[model samples]
Target: MDMKKMAGDKAAEYVKDGMVVGLGTGSTAYHMVNAIGERVKNGLKIQAIPTSKATEAQARELGIPLLTIDEVDHVDLDIDGVDEIDPQFNAIKGGGGALYREKVVATLAKEVIWIMDESKLVDHIGAFHLPVEIAQYGSKQAMARMEECGWKPVLRVRDGKTFVTDNGNYIADLHLGAGFDIEDVREKLGTIVGVLEHGLFLNMCKRMIVGTSSEGVRVIENPSK
Candidate 1:
């Protein structure tokens, strides 16, 4: 079975009528958006904010009502995917280069849900390189600063060119190894002048749904929620 599809489709069921939804980016999120689109075709009434241009286009093609962030007072629920997630519900995102916008949407969301396959679960979050979005201006200096802190920053490149995010920023993936101090690294990254946002999503998830081979789809409510 397609675990990503299982998790994503399960999360889409949470969207109720007359709610403002935050549609996320990436492969797993693609399934959620597709499921939500089907509901829309069946008369689900909801306005949606897409986290990336790709998501926006998909939602538009599916006739999902699109609304800018400015048009909505707040997002009722934001369903997204994570690269890696710890037992504590902390996660690493931005593998899709949508971290900046994803964070923005999550910040304004009253509730957040992350859907993922079982493989994404981990004892710690550092296995997946954390992505930090930075401005192009002085990016080299910023990366040098990150190196000085031993975060092992690497500029993201795609198709033989620097990968630019939809927000027109560069992503620096940090190889922080396992068991690194999340707070300390977050603080240090924040001090970098060119840094705009990092992939560390701490305390923002309200629930997590995982698709497992054995159990099928499992839902874990955030204890802190």
Candidate 2:
């Protein structure tokens, strides 16, 4: 089976009837939504909270039922994609700028599962420039602060215009050194006035399903038990 599709399909199996689910963004997540749509068509009843406006639009078109956060106390599961994952299951996410909602859903859900192709697994989380969504008003100040933390911060732009998030905020790409202290940096960024949320997801995922060309599918549960 194709790695991307297999990752998505396997994650879809975690969804059950009458559950409030969190729908994630990106290509791998798009495949998950497609699989869920098939189950929905066959009467797998559930409400979905989409992580982005783009995903909401896609879910609507596919006829997957959607609900607001206010309408649900807790989500049964959230399946998302990560840019990279380490041995400890720490992740770098939000390449699509939906970190705010993704984090909200992941924290609010009972279980969070990340689906990714084998190529995304890394020894450390810094290989991909972490994306941080920030408020437009204090971005300049925030950028300076980020640089003080040893990250080369740059405004993210796509097709000549800034890549605004679904929440209408700007994104900054941060380059950090390998073996950098992620927990320390995450706490530091959390105190920053302008940041909405950074792409570094720590201690959130309960399980990760990684798909590979040769291995097919690999499931990893958190080892901190």
Please tell me which predicted candidate would have the highest lDDT against the true structure: 1
Candidate 2 per-residue lDDT, tens place, 49-89, comes to 99999899999998999998778889999999998888888
lDDT of each: 0.96, 0.89
Indicate the residue-level lDDT of 104 in model 1. 95
Candidate 1 lDDT, 28-99, residue by residue in tens: 999999999999999999999999999999999999999998887799999999999999999999999999
Give the RMSD in angstroms, all C-alphas superposed, for model 1: 0.6
Clashes of each: 0, 0
| Clash-forming residue pairs, model 1 | none
Over 4 Å off, model 2: none
